[model samples]
Target: MNLKDFKAKLKNKIWRNVKAYFYDQRIADSTLVQNINLSTAQNQKKAIVSYVTYSHFNDWENNNIGRTQPFEILSMVKVLTELNYAIDIVGCHDLKTLDYLKLKNYDLIFGFGETFYQLTMLHPNAKSILYMTEHHPNFTKIEEQKRLDYFYDRKKKKANTVRTGNFYWDHHMKKKYTHVITMSETEPFNTEYTKPFNIFPTGILNNNFKLKPKNHDSSKKHFLWFGSYGAIHKGLDLLFDVFQKHDDIVLHVAGFYKDDRQLLEFPNKKNIIDYEYIDIQSNQFLEIIETCTYCILPSCSEGFSTAITTTMRHGLIPIVMENTGFNRLNELAFFLNDFNIEYIDKQLKEYSTKDSEYLASLSEKVFSFANSNFSIHAFESKFNVILNQILKND
Candidate 1:
């Protein structure tokens, strides 16, 4: 490794270990019934959001580094407070056991986790909302396995499946909810829940990125694959297979990969550039944004990828797999109807051959669409409407 890359990796490792130590210490001292109350009045209606409370515990304003969950969680609390409801926040994964007696008096239970499931069962009279951030667990499990099997068939080696559902299988089994809110298409949830589902667009960090002029003729041959974790599940392996064979096409990869060996297996391909982990706010990401014309991900499942949306906001025309919760974006994106190596290779080559004018126009459309639909303001407004409907039982 080069000196610069080696220093960055070492810095990241040290920071991660330090952060984990403090995080674990905080968890050890945390209490079961402790909550962050946001009530304007004493007699306001009470609601409990069983999601990430770490947003409240940290200096989120300054240390906003990864994912949109922290902002989304804070937005949910803000909406609940504005609705005249006293809100209590809990970390979904932090609790080993919940105090049922202490929580039974809450008028509403929202978000997803084992605690959400337990509360839904314990208080049948409460307004329970299941916030699904992914495809139904069954769908996710089956699809991830399918990708793993496909990888094994091609490579003659096994890789770990990293995209397994966070919520247990039994969380949805035979459970009824007052309303179901999702960030993706609702069709996948049909197999798991009979309840009505409401959809909201996932939010992206608007870095206020300004689009710059580019030579689409040159950039069109360059593609980007940006994601976090679950490299195989996000179809990075498939991308490696396609780009490595065709030196004419360049694939720029960003994001964390847990399986280093999976990366080592396909090393030293001149056509592929790996920028391991990237911050969207960094100059490295901006340089990549300027270099690539298309952002591609063939992920097996998603609840609307913010990764894709973020790239779209930066004027990268999206080329994504069909039915991976991107059906809503079909008009703005190029959809791959199949996931096989032959199909991907055929489609990508066809896409890269488009004229510069055509590529630029499509990129503008994608950027405008993403800015209109996937902003934090858009997410908050849509979520507010959904929450009101649930509260009023409309």
Candidate 2:
């Protein structure tokens, strides 16, 4: 391998190990920061953000190249800091009971997890803002169970629920918050909130790779499935069943699937190319974008699906499930009405048969839509507006 490829692999390996440690250990007592570089005015406001804490210690410049959470956490901190709040950040998995004596002085509580829940309950005078990055827990549980049942009916074996919400009771649907900020559409699924409900645009990394001309004649029959974990919940199984029957179509799979070995060993796996855990900045991702005309995801639930938007930024037409928080795409995307094998098979076949010029036009539209709505700048701008409104209303 070349030095660049070797470095990328090494960085991924190290990041995996770090994430595994955090997930496995669940370091609840560890604080990311006490008072993050703020002036210690006696009457200054204080806020606690319960989200990904490890982002503070990692390579900030490279955080955007993989998962969107690190960049998101850092951006939240920036906004809160500019609002004249001294912030403290904690990991979402920190579920240990918090000390009430020390935390009672905070003026605002943000983000999700046990930390947010405890603070919101203890400090009645503080403004509690729930930062929702997924669907409501009730909606997520029901949809995930339905997907699991469908998988069992097909395979005659039960699969683990991989994409369900972690804390159901901490959401705005179950409890009261001063304001709720979400990254997904929350109309019918999460209408329980009486406070101000704000939806922010999901962000995508700006890759440095040059865009290459796509061969739509060849790519019209090629499809890409890009997601992180939750292979079944994201409807990769449906893709496997459909693509296995049609040998002419090519499906390029990216992202790390927990069931990678089992899912990749399907009946006719020749047409399915698996590039596990792809970095968005890598040439491998660029090659996949050049070869694929469509990016398909039938996830049960999502918060704008950064994976889909990331693929769209590279000129791939999105084929996503309807009402899974991507309704904003309107006509810019092809919405799958059903997740069954027959329905998906029909849709993929019909989409593949479109003329090369028509498919290219759709690709350009998707690229433009994603570029306009899902950039990092868009996320920061929308969030700043939402935060200002929340503060001004108080």
Q: Which candidate is the best by lDDT?
A: 1
Q: Report per-prediction Cα RMSD to one decimal.
A: 9.2, 9.2
What 10-residue stretch in candidate 2 is worst by lDDT?
24-33
lDDT of 2: 0.77
Cα deviation in Å at residue 276, candidate 1? Answer: 0.7
Question: Over the stretch 311-386, how does candidate 2's per-residue lDDT look in tens digits?
Answer: 8888888899888778878988899988888989999989998888887777778777777777767777778888
Question: Where does candidate 1 have its weakest 10-residue lDDT segment?
Answer: 27-36
lDDT of every model, 2 decimals? 0.78, 0.77
Per candidate, the number of residue pairs that clash is 0, 0
> How many Å off is the CA of 146 in candidate 2?
1.2
> What does candidate 2 score on TM?
0.86
